[model samples]
Target: MPVDQPHSSAPDILHGWGARQRGGRIRVKGGGQVSQIYAIRQAIAKGIVAFYQKYVDEQSKNEIKDILLTYDRTLLVADPRRCEPKKFGGPGARARFQKSYR
Candidate 1:
């Protein structure tokens, strides 16, 4: 089943890039930092795997079939949809509206 809608992070990454704002960095397990752009790619790959697994024939040797295998190698980033918003001891993924004093 193809995805019913575009993934949210796709637009976020594009907008970030267009605005010349480099994304946040992730620390590697062994120790090193990498841009969040890599995370976006991994998320996209995971989305593809989830949506297209039903259509892919594992026994097939076709070129198109082989392309699906690429999704299996995602190791850096987990899909945003599967993750809960970081609460950080406060409201999650939400901003508090400022009180306006007239």
Candidate 2:
């Protein structure tokens, strides 16, 4: 379950590993740069759960399974250099263009 940085992502991955016993609620809370994206996604998922709960939806469990499956796997497997915006030919590395003075 290692993401971008092994050292930074270690604690979050460990937290998720033992969450299955607690009704599969993965609690990833911290103040780290690498964990922000994951924490945001978890918060969003919790909101979705609340929505389903109000509606008495039975498909929520399956949806949670899909989310867990996606989180558990390495969704991004591209080389770091290949991910630069310039590689896609839209603009420069920062996706910015030089101002034309014409």
Pairs of colliding residues, candidate 1: none
Q: Model 2 segments beyond 4 Å from truth?
A: 1-30, 64-102
Across residues 16-78, which tens digit of lDDT does each residue of candidate 1 receive? 222234355433343122324445555544444443445555442233224534423333244
**All candidates: TM-score:** 0.26, 0.31
Indicate the TM-score of model 1: 0.26
Model 2: residue 81 alpha-carbon error in angstroms: 31
CA lDDT of each candidate? Answer: 0.40, 0.46
Compared with the true structure, the alpha-carbon lDDT of candidate 2 equals 0.46
